[model samples]
Target: MLKLRKLNAYYGTSHIIHDLDLDVRKGEIFCILGRNGVGKTTLLRSLLGIDTRTRGSIELDGVDISEAPTYKRAQFGIGYVPQGREIVPGLNVLENILLGCNARSDGRRDVPPLVWTLFPFLKEHLTRRGTNLSGGQQQQLAIARALATDPRVLVLDEPTEGIQPNVVADIEKAIVSLNRDHGLTVILVEQKIRFARTAAQRFVILEKGRVAAAGAAAELSNELVRKHMSL
Candidate 1:
């Protein structure tokens, strides 16, 4: 449902991403992988129109969105959960989730019961302050907040960055549910190889701001991983 072509981005004259092109098919999880500082985040920013210095075409479905603002992109069904799980520290869990409703067109809003059913811990912590929750809980909150928007496509940047194994398992299960059960399109930008295997149906590896490798996830071999992502 998302497509980008010949994408170029600059950060104050330091050209970071160049000539990037990829597509996230509807009802599939497509991953963009690269080492640190290789412009994965820049690509995500370009898609969201967060980088004013970007040059290229970004489209949701068939509509051009290169010049669209961040809110407009969100309105176009691009829900983003950034790398850091940027939840409000002072807001209670329910309050934090309510902010996601701003992306919706209708005034009447509701969080899907499945959201709480998936993360029952959040139900108990509804009135609890965000700052009081542990890191994993905060990560769950971030995902919940994005899901609260009920977007057609979900863009998640490094969802497992600092999460523990069990929590990561839960998040992965949630993603699978969203994909297979709900048919949400996903654009996952991540560096974790093991986790990458779990979510990605196709792979696009970026290096020095360009696509160096891409294919069916099942086709990614040990040699490819070694050359492109090994530390």
Candidate 2:
């Protein structure tokens, strides 16, 4: 239930996302696929009102949020797990997760039950420092923290990038479960084509900051990957 129209994003006059138009339906996983430097991360930042400056319309459930601040967007039901995970270095696992509660409209500090259910490991290590965890564990912690916001739309940028192969599968499975079983809308910026094809209901391939190809997951063919995403 998110829509973007004519979205142009910039980082200090270096234009990134260019007049992009996209739609993410309710309770579905929508993948954004592109090679490095194609503005995938910039687009996510634009949606979240992060560093990049943006122009045009961003609508969440029919209400315009183009001018809303990052926290306001989060309060409006967009949860972000950034590209690097960006786990707060000094915070314990529980404390890091509780940080997301600041975005909650209700202003509750309690972590949602869903976060524990999806990542039971987090519960056991609630006292552990977030930065002390493994890469995959930190990624899980990031996702768990985002879930603590109780967002209607989960926006993840490269959730499995550089993750251990064993843990990558777990991350993929969690994303699928979140969309299919938990009824959450996911906007995923993913590098892994195989996982994207299997988990996403629809996808768009970006080139030079704009949609080059977009269709159902089944249409993410070998030819398309070779054309838009091959190194």
Candidate 3:
């Protein structure tokens, strides 16, 4: 569903991602794994047009989106839940989710039933200020907001980062359900090796802004993990 070829990204004058190539098939969870500073987040940002500059090709569902603006890309069915879960601090939970409706072609603003199904807690607290929620709750709210976009491809950057352990499992299950049951195409940048192994069909390990090793998830052996990911 998504492909990148010879992609390079820069922040200001300093390049971060170098000649990177990747592919994510429809209805599959494609995980990106790497140590810090390997351009994992940069890659996601480039795909969404958030980086300072980018070169080469970015295609989604066979359509080239390399030159599209960020909003246009979102309207093209790319829902991004950025690494920090950048929920608006002032908006209520419901309002925050509704923000994603800006990308909807149908012009509807109601929260999708799927969000309520994935996170029942959010439905009950629609009036609560988004910033008042716990980190994990905030993360769920972030995902809910993205789901409100009615996207064909969900781009998640570290959905489980800095959450409580119990909530991490909940987030993981939600991600799995989104991909396995709902058939949403996913491009995930994840640090949790166990979840990546269990949930992803394929993965790419990045090193110094380029792909070092990539293959079926089952092939992400312990030795490979130690060599590339262990700090």
lDDT pick, better of 1 and 3: 3
lDDT of each: 0.84, 0.95, 0.94
Model 1 residue 112 CA deviation in Å: 2.2
Each prediction's TM-score versus the true structure: 0.96, 0.99, 0.99
Better of 1 and 3 by TM-score: 3
The C-alpha stretches of model 3 lying farther than 4 A from their native spots are: none
Model 2 scores a C-alpha lDDT of 0.95
Task: Indicate whether candidate 1 or candidate 2 has the larger lDDT.
Answer: 2
**Ordering by TM-score:** 2, 3, 1
Model 1 per-residue lDDT at 97? 83
Per residue, candidate 2 scores C-alpha lDDT tens digits across 20-81 of 99999999999999999999999999999999999999999999999999999999999999
Q: State the displacement of the C-alpha of residue 186, model 3, in Å, after optimal TM-score superposition.
A: 0.8
**Candidate 3 lDDT score relative to the true structure:** 0.94
Report the error of model 2 at residue 68, Å. Answer: 0.6
